[model samples]
Target chain A: GAGVSQTPSNKVTEKGKYVELRCDPISGHTALYWYRQSLGQGPEFLIYFQGTGAADDSGLPNDRFFAVRPEGSVSTLKIQRTERGDSAVYLCASSDIAGAREQYFGPGTRLTVT
Target chain B: AQSVAQPEDQVNVAEGNPLTVKCTYSVSGNPYLFWYVQYPNRGLQFLLKYITGDNLVKGSYGFEAEFNKSQTSFHLKKPSALVSDSALYFCAVRDMLDTGNQFYFGTGTSLTVIP
Candidate 1:
C-alpha cells in the first residue's frame, strides 16, 4: 500500500511569490492534515480536513495560508505572498478517520522562500 | 490549552544500552498520547500510541512507551539502543474533549546512539 506522498520534494521561490504544495493521502483515508516543520523544531499543525470539509483551520498561521481537498483523496496547500518566514518543510498526513490519533506522514515539500 | 513538552533537547547513549526519552503533556480531559520519529530528510513515522487500556504500549522499530496518568507523562524507552535508532523523537497529545482532532507536538528530542 502506498503511504502518503507529496509532490515537488523541494521548491525554491522568491518572497511575495505564490506556491502550492500537493499531497496524496493513503487510500480510504478520510482525514487529511497539513503541518509545517522548521529547522530543529517539531511539526506544527496547519489545517485538518475530515472527508471533503475542513474540520479545523485554526492552525493556519494567517490569512495567506489556505488548503483544499476537493475530491477527498488529494489535497493542496496554497500560500499567497510567500515570505522568508515561510521557509520550512511542509508536511501532509492522513488517517483513517478524524478521531484516529495515529497519522501517516508524507516525505514533505521543502519550500525555501528567499 | 493542550500541549506537550520534551524536557531534553537531546539524548546520547551507546549502542546496546537502554534508552529513555521523556515527554509530558497537559490537556483538559483524558488524553491520547502518541510518539513519532523523524529521520533526516524524511517524514515523521508513527512509533506508538496510548489511547486506552494497558499503560505499557509497544510500537514499531523495537520501541515502547509507558503512559503514566499521575505524572502526566508518556516516556519512550528501548531495551537496547541501536545506532540506527538515532533520530528526532516527538511526543504528541490530543485532547479528548476536542472533536477537531489535532495533535499538539513537543519541541522534539534528538537521539544519538554511538556504536
Candidate 2:
C-alpha cells in the first residue's frame, strides 16, 4: 500500500510570502496530522484532522498557520506571511480510523523562508 | 502538558554489541509511548509502540522497548547493533486526555553503530 505522500519536496520563498504544502494520505486513512521539525530538534505538532473537520488545532503555532482537509483524504498546510523562523521540514502523517493506530509518514516538505 | 525526555544526546555502540537508548515521559494520564527512527533526509519511520498490556513490547528491526510505569520510562533496546542502525531516534508520548491527538516528542538521540 502506498504511504502518505507530500508534494513539492522543497520550497524556497522570501519572508512575508505565502506557501501551501500538500499531503495525500493512504487510501482509507481517516486521520491526518501535520508537524514541523527544525534543525537538531524533533517534530513539533502543528494540527490534526479527523475526517473533514479538524478535531484539534491547538498545536497550531499561531493564526498564520492553517490546515484543511476538505475531502477527508488530502490535506493542505497553509502558511501566511511566512517568517524566517518558520523554516523547517513540514511532515504529514495519516492513520487508520482508530485514533490510536500507528501513523504512516510522508517524506515531508522542506520549507525555507529566506 | 505532556512531554518526553531523551537524556542522552548520542549513543555509540560497536557492531554486535548491545545497544540501549533511554527515554522518559511525563503525562497527566496514561501514556501511549512510541519509538521512531529517522535517517537523513527521510521521514520518521515507526519502530514500536507500547499502548497497554505487556510491559515489554517488541518491534521492527529486532528492536524492543520496555514500558516501566513506576519509573515513567520507555527505553529502546536491541540485542545487537549494526552499522546500518545509525540514525536519529525519537521517543514520543501521548496523553490519554489530550483531545488533540498530538504526540509530544523528545529532543532526539543520535545512535552510531561502529563496525
Candidate 3:
C-alpha cells in the first residue's frame, strides 16, 4: 500500500509571501497531523485533525499558521506572510482510527523562505 | 511539561557490532513510547513502540526497544549493526492521560554505522 504523500518536494519563496503545502494521507486514515522540522532539530507538532475537524491545534506556532483537513483524507498547511524563521521541512502523518498513537509519516515538503 | 530526551547527539558503531540508542522521557501518566528512523530525504519510519504489557518490544528491521519503568527509558537496540542502518533516530512519547494527546519528540540522535 502507498504511504502518505506530500506535494512539492521543495519550495522557495520570498519573505512575507503566502504558501500552501498539501498532503495526501494513506487511504482510510481518519487522523492527520502536521509538523515542522528545522535543520538539526526534531519535528515540532503543528496541527492535528480527527476526521474533518481539527481536534488539536495548540501546536500551531501562531495565527499565521493554519491547516485544514476538510474531507479527512487530505490536509493542507498554509502559512501567511512567511518569515525566514519559518523555513523548515513540513511533515504530514496519518494513523488508523484503531491505533491513533502509531502514525505513518510522509516525505516532507521543504519550504525555504528567502 | 511532557518531553523526551536523547542525551547523545550522535552514536557511531562498527558494522556487525551491537548498537544502542538511548531515550528517556518524562510524562504525567502511563506513556506511549515509540522509536522512529529517518533516512536522508525521507520521512520517519516507525521502528517499534511500547504501549503496555511487555517491557521488551520488537519491531521492524530486527530492531528492539526495552521499556524501563524505573528509569523511564526506552533504548533502541540491535544485535548487529549494518552500514545501511546509519540514519537519524528519534524517540517520541505520547501522554495518553493528557487531554491534548500530543506527541513529544526528542532532539534526535544521528547514528553512523561504520563499515
What is the overall TM-score of model 3 with all chains considered together? 0.98
What lDDT tens digits, residue by residue, belong to model 1 across residues B10-86?
99999999999999999999999999999988889999999999999999999999999999999999999999999
Off by over 4 Å in 3: A98-100
Q: Clashes in model 3: which pairs?
A: none
Judged by DockQ cut-offs, the docking class of candidate 2 is medium
Report per-candidate DockQ. Answer: 0.82, 0.74, 0.66
Q: For residues A1-114, what per-residue lDDT tens digits would candidate 2 score against the true structure?
A: 788899999999999999999999999899898999999888898888999999989889999999999999999999999999999999998988644677888999999999
User: Can you give the TM-score per candidate against the true fold?
Assistant: 0.98, 0.98, 0.98
What residue pairs clash in candidate 2, if any at all? none
- lDDT against the true structure, each candidate: 0.95, 0.93, 0.93
Against the true structure, whose DockQ is highest? 1
What are the per-residue Cα lDDT tens digits for candidate 3 across B10-107?
Answer: 99999999999999999988889999999999999999999999999999999999999999999999999999999999999988787665888999
What tier of docking accuracy does candidate 1 attain? high
Superposition error at A85 for model 2 (Å)? 0.6
